[model samples]
Every structure is written in structure tokens, then in C-alpha cells.
Target: MSKSAVSPMMQQYLGIKAQHTDKLVFYRMGDFYELFLDDAVEAAKLLDITLTTRGQMDGVPIKMAGVPFHAAEQYLARLVKLGKSVAICEQVGEVGAGKGPVERKVVRIVTPGTLTDSALLEDKETNRIVAVSPDKNTSVWRGHRCKAANSKPS
Candidate 1:
């Protein structure tokens, strides 16, 4: 895509996405968290969801896919099980509140090692977020609840 053809919203997403390269970014827009480009393609294939185009950039259609926020827990559970991490980007303000695109930011990074929602966990299962000792003889697991999914605390 040509640099000139990118929309402000897409640019905003790219900016937040740059910070977390290894994780899938679940960018929240309206009632759903949308995925674009490779993120959309990968997720659509994995989740068997429809892959569609939202807009065009440089005359090429921009690929997009999304799951409703209400159904996100199931998708999150599936992705976590597949060993893919997710970064949630939430809208931070009312539309047009800013001079440009709607304000949004990465709110949370979800990984298999850091899961606390019982809905996402299977019965009789456990998850441990760990750090290994320099000698490799010891490991530390952090067992705590996840932060509220927000880039800025309310």
C-alpha cells in the first residue's frame, strides 16, 4: 500500500501495533474488535470467520475481519489455546472528540501464561506465568488477576 493511501484510523492502528509485534492486536471499533491486514487473514483462517474488505488503500482493498465484543471471550480462549497472544486496543473517547481519528490504545496483552478468567479456563486446569532463574534451577510464577483492559485507567 502506498503511504499516501492509508487512512488516519489505519495509521493510528499501525502506531499501536508497532509496540507489540508478536501478539495479535484486537482493535476495538464499535461493538466489535476488528483486525486488519495479516492479523485479519490469520484470525479469519483460524476461527473460520468470513474475511472481507473494509476500504481500499492505494487502490487495493484493505482486508478486514472481526468478532463481536460479546463473543470475544470464546475467541480469546481459542487463540490463547493456539499459543497466540492478543493485544486489545480500545477506543478511548467519543468519535470526533479529537481533531483526527477516534482515540484508541492498547489496553491489554493476553497470553497463555497469564490467564485468570475462569470462563476462559477449563475445569481442573491451571496457568502459570513464569520467570526462570539465571542458573535455570528455579522458576517464579506470577499468579494474579489481569489488569482491566484499558490503556488508561478510568
Candidate 2:
């Protein structure tokens, strides 16, 4: 399949996924958050959800998996607990707003290190954010050189 063969919606998804290759993309589609390709494969295994092939992209089958929009919180919490980052892509435009696919954007990126949502955090545990910076100055140590003394053979 060629680039032209790919659907507009998929093209939009690809564009977002390209920017967030390190995170699983929860792409909003209708009433479900869909994951595609490698995201689909990894998320399906991690979330214990069904993995199915939707269509094709560039001659390869496009793997897909999804969770219902209404019950996404539990799934998201689990993913975060297991040290996975997710990019939440939501439909920003109305259904009848335009002629082509409705405009969508990544509204939020949730990661294990950046957990702030009450739903994703534990009630009793304390949360901390740590920032590590490299030292800009390099230090040089000075040492005294010693001359070797000649010894007589015994």
C-alpha cells in the first residue's frame, strides 16, 4: 500500500505518533481510545486487551487495540503503575466541523514520573518530582612529578 492508500484519520494518527514515539498513544476514535501499530501490540499485551488488525499501512497490516472511553481511567492507571507513558489524543474539532476528518490533538502526556492526577496516584503514598542536572564545570587535579633514583646492583 502507498501513502495515498492510507486514510486521512490514520495520517493524522501517524503524525501524532511520530512526535510521541516513546509513549503509547490513546487515540480518541468515537467512544473508544484506539492504539495502532507497535503501540497497539505493546498496549494489548500490557493492558490484557484484544489485539486485532484493522487494515493495512504501506503493505503491512496495521495492528489495533482499544479501550472504551468511559472506562479509560482504570486502564490508564494500570499502565502508569507499570511504568508506561501515554499520550492522550482527543478530538478537538466537532464531528460536523469540517469536510475531512475531525481535527485531533494530543491533549496530555501522562508518565510515571509526572503523575499528578488524583485518579492515577495512590491515596496514602507521597509523590515527589526530581530533576537531575549535570555539572557544567570540570576540575583538574595537579600532582607533583618525582624523579627516579639510580640504585646499585646487589
Candidate 3:
């Protein structure tokens, strides 16, 4: 079968996966975060998790692996520690009328280079990724040192 013949779910996954090609996408499906395609293959080996086939698409088994959503933070920490990034995609809305799939969106991306969640940060004040200019006055700091995302610097 061709790409067009693939399942709607797979199509949705592919669309979102395209946005974060360099990061593994943790696609939220109920209690589990599913990994598909190369993410599945790579994560399974790296995380030492079971790699299994959930279903078939285009006459091929759609490779997949997943971890319980409740334990996702641990997995995310492990992956990030290994210098891997992860895109957290969650169902955003109801399926709506007709045959539409549940809406989903990438809520956040976690990378080894940056960490904001206090649970993931040890020395909250020092560990950071910043762009420092030769001028002592001009410094752009990231991580928790940054201003609120929804506010303007005053």
C-alpha cells in the first residue's frame, strides 16, 4: 500500500513527526506514550524497552513502542540525559463529528541542552545554556533565568 493508503492515525503521527525530525515524538495515546517509526526503533534500543507492532499499515507492520504516561518523566529524563530531544504531543480536543481523529498537538519539547522543570534541574541557578557576547552587558540566558514566556520584559 502507498502512503495515501495508510491509516488516519499514522497520517496524523507523520504530520506531527515531520515538525520535529530531530526529536523523538512521544505521541500520547491514552495511558501510554507511543513511539512510531524510527523513534520506536531507536528508543526501544536506547531505553531497553520492548519494541512491538501495534498494527499494520501499507502491508507493513507499523513499528511501535511505548511507556506508561505516568512514568514518562523518568523516560524523558533518561532520553534527555542521552542527548536526545523529545516532543510531547497530547490530545488537544474531542474527535468531533464524522470520522475525524482526536486532535493532538506538540505541547513541549525537552532537550539535553535545556531544562526548565525544577524536577529535572539540580543547581537551578548555575546550570544553563546562554548566548554570551564579548560585551559584559549583553547576555542572553535561557533555562529558569529567562523571563516569563507570556510577559513582556519591562
Candidate 4:
């Protein structure tokens, strides 16, 4: 679908999603953070949250799912534990503060390999982040890296 065909809010979401295609976008909408389209579908399944349609794009309904902002930490912990990364898109401006849609941005990106939240970690054990990458020289070669990150309250 053309850019002009989508709502301004969706346009903003698309712009951010484009930058992090590999991660789910948690778009802030009022008291909740919403996931749309494919993100909604996947999150609904993984998080066992309600999945519904909001609007239409092109010729299809826009799938959507959301978690209350106040309880987002639990949902986020679940996703991170399930090996999913999330781009937390937050509303950075007041409603109706601008001529267009409320301004939003990816305030933080939480990945399994970059977890630093105290609530998501075990109380007594040291938490760690692990990463693996394919080697450049040979097809079968790969490298792994690990780092310990002490979780702290945010």
C-alpha cells in the first residue's frame, strides 16, 4: 500500500518498524502499548493476549494487540524470555500537541542479548547476554560472545 493510504500514526510506526524489522514494535497508544499487523499476530500468540482488528489497509484488516502500560513489564519479560526482541515506541509528546499525530519514538530496545531490567532477572544469579554470529571466512564457521550484565531497577 502507498504511504498516503495509511494513517499518520501508522506511518510513524512504519518508519520505526522499517529500522528494526527483526524486532517487534511496541507502539504507545494512550494507556497501552499496541502491536499491529504481523507483530500483533505473533505477540497475541506468544503472550496469549487478545487479538483484534482496528482498521483497514489496502484491502485487509489491520490486526492489533496490546498490553496495559502499567503491566508492560510482565509482558516484556515474557517476550524477552521467549527470545524475542522489542522496540519500545513511546509517545514523546502531549496529545493534540501537534498538528499531526502525537510524536513517538523508540525509547528503548530490549533484546534477550541486552536485557538489563531487574524484574526480568533471577534474584540471586548473575544475568548474562549471549550473541552468536556467522564467521566471514567459511560457511560453517560461527563465533559466540557472552557478557554478564547486572540487572538494576530502572
Candidate 5:
């Protein structure tokens, strides 16, 4: 089998991946959300899909698999509902075809609420994404934080 390789941009993403290792990472690569090494294997098992491998990382073989960007939100929702966290790695710079190295970065990390896709979101319910920094000082709360204060105690 041909070993898929990770670009320089992807290498940078691996750094972010280390932070959220327990989470199913959607490392954005070009038009697809790529998973590398163990991440690919785990996602494939959880999603009941195919498992493949990509080039090498630190001189070690790397496995990989991915879903298209358009359908990513749907897949993400499924993983989330199953209590799996995801880290979205996005390309920051404008790197087109044959433009040498593509500048990429982990633009936004989506957990639950931060999702903007209508298909993955519920129309009648509210979705929220919360983030807590390591310092325990910078906590970002996304979406509505409102709770029903006066409910019929049933």
C-alpha cells in the first residue's frame, strides 16, 4: 500500500493534536479533514469505516483517513453525540495548487456548541461549546448559557 505523506503544514497540526490526543482530531488538509497515525485507526473503528496509512512522522509510519469538508460537520456531530471530542485544524494561509508550501494552522477548535452547521444542529434545541484553558483563567463559553430558572417542579 502506498504510504500517504504529511505535508509541512500537517506537521504543525500534529503539535496541536498532542494537546487533544483523547479527542478525534479533524486535521484539515486541503479539501479534506485528515486523521493521522493512531487517530485514523481509532476514527475508522468508531465510524465503522476504512483504515489507511500515510507517510512517516518522526521516522515512524503514520496511518491516516479522512472525510470531505462538506460532510465533516455531520461526522463531527456523530462523534460528539458519542461523547468524543474533536479538534479542527484549518489552513490559515492561501495556498493554492502548486504554490509550494501551504501555510496552515489550527484556526478553531470545535467541541460541541461552536458548531455552525444547520444539519448537525437541532432546530428546537440549543447547542453550546465550552473551552477551558490550562491556566484556569481564560474560559470561553460559546452559545447560550441560559437555563430555565422557573420550571414547573414536576
Candidate 6:
């Protein structure tokens, strides 16, 4: 049986996924990252992979796809680089929490510039990210700094 089979936290995560049925959420489950239902369908389409389904929850079939935990940063980088916004759901308690279920919530949402893990970023090139406000009058830019000493003669 999978960890999710006996864990209420996993069930709650699934609930959260159901709420955001439109976006592809990287639901972090234990040492692997997973996608459920429509998110899985969309990710498989976008990533060019097979679409598969998992167990039923609340009488509805759950679609899923996953990658190892260690590889998640890299995978997330690729998705973000491809202009996909991702919400990261993280488990909040230690392994043996006995309080009905462990606590879990979205630790952060990964966007282009907010990425801090060096393993998921390029060292030589700048990772540029832009945010445009809904009003169309405001904009924000975030990225690494440019070195004045490294400037080339024009």
C-alpha cells in the first residue's frame, strides 16, 4: 500500500488539488512529487508523456504522474522555464506525527524569478522574470544582478 493509502494528510492534499482544478499543481507527496486528475492530464499533454490514472477518491478516478523528490527542483525549473506557474504543496510535520494526520500546506509557489535553488538555475546566464499587473499599469522585474566590470565594449 502507498503512504497515501493510510495518511489523512495525503487525502487533504487531494482535496486541495480538487479546489484548483484548472492549474497544474505539483503536489508534494513524501519523497516524490505527484499530479492528480485534470492536472495530470494537462501535464502529460504539456510534457509530452502518457496520461495515466490512479486510485479513486470520493468515487472519482484520480489521475497522477510523479518524479523523485530529489529531481523535483530540476523538473520544476523546466516547467517554470516553459512559462508554467506551479504551486508547491509540502508536508509540515515529522514522519511519526500521531495527531489524526500530519499538517500539510502550500509552502510556496514557484515562479520564474523567485526560484532560489542553484541546482535549478543557470550560473552563467540571467534568469529573467516579469510580472504584469491586472490593471495593465504596473509591472515588476526580478533577476540576478549585472556586473559592471563584466560589461563588454560596444
The candidate that wins on TM-score is 4
| lDDT (10s digit) by residue, model 5, range 5-82 | 556555566667778876777877768998877789988888876778676765767788889899887788788767
lDDT, model 3, position 49: 99
Candidate 3: misplaced stretches above 4 Å? 95-98, 122-126, 133-154
Which model, 3 or 6, shows the larger lDDT?
3
Q: Rank by lDDT, highest first.
A: 4, 2, 1, 3, 5, 6
Reference-based lDDT, residue 153, model 4? 38
Show the lowest summed lDDT stretch of 10 residues, model 1: 145-154
Each model's RMSD to truth, in Å?
6.8, 15.9, 6.4, 4.9, 7.8, 7.2
Q: Which residue pairs show backbone clashes in model 4? A: none
| Local distance difference test values of all predictions, in order | 0.82, 0.86, 0.82, 0.87, 0.68, 0.66
Candidate 3 lDDT by residue in tens digits, 16-131: 99899999999999899999988999999999999999778877898999999999988997897788999999988775645767889999999877776654544324354555
lDDT score, candidate 2, position 49: 99
Which parts of model 5 are misplaced by more than 4 Å? 1-7, 96-100, 112-118, 123-154
Task: Give the alpha carbon lDDT tens digit for every residue of 1-154 in model 6.
Answer: 2445534655676677666554567777678778866778777777765667776655566677876778877777778778777887877777576766566677767766466555556556445444543444556544445322212232
Maximum-lDDT candidate = 4
Q: Give the Å error, residue 107, model 3.
A: 0.5
- lDDT, candidate 1, 1-154, per-residue tens: 5656798888888788788878889999999999988999999999999899988877888889999999998999999999889999999889878587888988788888777666677655545444533444556544444342323222
**With candidate 5 superimposed using the best TM-score fit, by how many Å does residue 106's alpha carbon deviate from the native?**
2.1
Q: Between 1 and 2, whose lDDT is larger?
A: 2
- lDDT agreement of model 3 with the native: 0.82
If candidate 6 were superposed on the true structure by all CA atoms, what would the RMSD be?
A: 7.2
lDDT tens digits, residues 1-154, model 2? 3557788888889889989999999999999999999999999999999999987898788999999999999999999999999999999999988787899999999998878787777666556665554455645444443322223222
Task: Return the TM-score for each candidate structure.
Answer: 0.80, 0.81, 0.79, 0.82, 0.65, 0.64
Taking all chains together, the TM-score of candidate 3 against the true structure is: 0.79
Q: Candidates ranked by TM-score, best first?
A: 4, 2, 1, 3, 5, 6
